[model samples]
Target: MMHNVSHVRFFFLSGFNETVNFKVALFSLTFMSYCVVVLVNVALIVIIILDKNMHEPMYILLCTFCMNGLYGTTSFYPKMLWDLLSPIHVISYSECIVQALVMYSFACCDLSILSVMAYDRYVAICRPLKYHSIMSKQRVLLLACFSWLTPFSISAINIILTSRLKLCSPYIDRLFCMNWVIVKLACFPTETIVNNIVSYVTIIIYLFHGLFIVWSYMYVIKTCVNSLENRAKFMQTCVPHLTSLLIFLITALFSVFNTLFGSTLPPTIQNVIAIELLIISPMMNPLVYGFKLTLIRNRILGGITLQMK
Candidate 1:
């Protein structure tokens, strides 16, 4: 028996099973949401780029974060919209792997960027004198590249490893292609040892990112407690980053848990939780930064007021 035989050519996505009756309504809502996401993120990016005043490292990082949100959402929204409208939800094997890669990398990059942002805040708050020297433009650019490239490389490797496996099934219970879900379809469990090891290493690495964030903020909060100036700085800057981090973690964790133990829930509820990260995080991040960050909020409002005139 050729254990490596891969007969699967397509994957059936059943995440939309419950939405058949309301597909049209869901499509409309999703379409509007996508548009809003694009508009806000692009608006923020343009504001940061055009206004030389907003070219500082922190704002630049925020722009990078918003751009990442756009990248991640772009991978999911179009396919999701198509799935919502189509009677049959199917994705080609190659495309499914690519989509899974993009989705996973996008998420991992988000955490990487957030981790960098946390460090940036830690430096700006804790080591105020050296913030500029430490987070220079060249360095920020390098950090941004690291955030994007590292995760993309990791995800690509995972996808490549997954491609070698012979899948026993072609159905993905969730709406989108996930690496883990695809791995679950492997014909033989023994083929997955490398995949599992790599996945665990990846998780540990990103988990360090989460821990770094917690530690960074602990010092930040403690530092702020002693000084009125630092407290105001923390409120002014750290809050938005904290909010974005909180939103990302909540959505990502829900999806992760859903993937792990969602069988007990109704399919509709499971699907919603599974996709909340892709939908809510993209839309919410821009809104959170646009409203919470004073400079960004002012720039956005100023742009609106100018266009009104």
Candidate 2:
């Protein structure tokens, strides 16, 4: 079979074919959801920035986490909303690669940020005296930059490798572009060997990130178990982090499973799974933190009450 690597400029997203009958409804819902996501995340970010009392390391991490959610969701929602209303669903190859980069980086950065948060909790509970010195503003800023730059560099490498493949098909079966899906379109399996290696290596690197988070929490829990004050601290600060981690892991696992076994499921179900991370994690993280953390909760409530006055 002859492959036309040079001429493949755009990829057709066939996932929209099933939505023609309800495009308008889908468009409205997607647009509104995107708006809500933006509003909530931005609200949290603003609250944290304006209130100097909330400028501590933990709150700074939370703000970065919300900003990441916004970054991840923005890459998908706008494209999706437009595709929902358009008759033809297509994305240029370059645009698809960029989307995949941003989406994957966003996810990887989420885990990295969570790892940093766990460390912050660990230091706060385990070594309270050194918490300030350890997580100083400069150190937190460095960790935050690491959380973002590391994942983006990794995802950029993946996208670059993916772009080198000679694609046999231009039709992507899903609603959005994904690195693995694009790699599967390669004309020859032998060419994807390097891609596969790098992909697994990336997975292992993040898997260790997951293990690190688990270890930090375990240590924190063990320490908190022996002390009443530590337990209270755990309840107030660590609980929200744990909730966010749980939400991220669930959505991430769904996405992975959908990628591996999705063809066996109905299209609608597959679509839902594909989008679960984008919708649920981004929207729920801020809500969980806003309500669970007393300081943030009081701040939000105080503002609401002032408006009522």
Candidate 3:
């Protein structure tokens, strides 16, 4: 029962750590991760964009994953960096609210992109001959557009409803900017409404996405069993996608566990899992995909060498 308030705002207590040394280390690590995450994803996008040889649907979906990585880092890096550098870490009420929404949106985009990638693999493996006709350039473009648009629409709805509420204090409990934390901190009666909307969004994104992934793998398994020639390629494709999904699912599970079990796990452990699932997963995607797929890596290296030459 959150009230529709326009003029109300909140104060965020960002200076949580008393030790200066901790802040310095946090800043250093954040700086390094931000650089690496951006570089790797940008490299992936550039490789796919420049290499006409790699203009297949799989690479196109990989490009979307790279974009999702950028969006994911953007949602938190700015504030985290700000908090690390300044002696007193602080964020405005509106800023926190917007960050919350952006966090969810980025998250939504990430899961959606991964789901699309899995589907791409399914098409590539299960329907090899029809892959080209089915996943034509136009269709790939349409799918990419839908991936972006779907998340943006859902994010907009969640944020619009979220922004309508009045937050008492912006002192969110959890680390690294989360919607749940901010929403929980907001002293509003209609917080339930916000949570309910979030609940609905979560169900829609994760449930359907998870179901599609399971279905894709099911078909993938069937294809694997029937085909002997391209078994290695098909299995390789499934590995990274499944690895990424499992890592993501584990993180989601922990968060749900912490919330439901009320076990009072240390916030540090929770943050570590969050960082692993967010920063670590995106950074690893390029390597995971590249190492597992010979063609992708070769194309990337060839693209780099060609540039240098």
Every candidate's lDDT: 0.91, 0.92, 0.73
What global local distance difference test value does model 2 have? Answer: 0.92
Give the CA lDDT, 0 to 100, for residue 175 in model 1. 84
Residue lDDT tens for model 3, 1-309: 434563445544433453256877888888898888888889888877887988888888888888887887777776678776777666666776677677677767777877888888888888889989998999998988888888877877766766666666656545555555555655666655756767676667678887988898888888888678657877767787777777677766765676565336665565555556567777888778777777778887777799999
> Where does candidate 2 stray beyond 4 Å?
1-6
Give a tens-digit lDDT track for model 2, residues 101-199.
Answer: 998899999999999999999999999999999999999999999999999999999988888889889999889999998999998899999999999
Q: Once model 2 is optimally superposed onto the true structure by TM-score, how far is the C-alpha of residue 148 displaced, in angstroms? A: 0.3
Per-residue lDDT tens digits of candidate 1, residues 1-309? 465757899999977788889988999999999999999899999989999988898999989998998998898999999999888999999999999999899999999999999999999999999999999999999999999999999999999999899998888888889899999999899999999999999999999999999999999999999999999999889998999999998988898788788888999899889788888888888888889888888888887899999
Model 2 pairs whose backbones collide: none
lDDT of 1: 0.91
Candidate 1 residue 163 Cα shift, in angstroms, is: 0.9
- Candidates in descending TM-score order: 2, 1, 3
> What TM-score does model 3 achieve against the real structure?
0.88
TM-scores, all models, native as reference = 0.97, 0.97, 0.88
Clash counts for the predictions, in order: 0, 0, 2
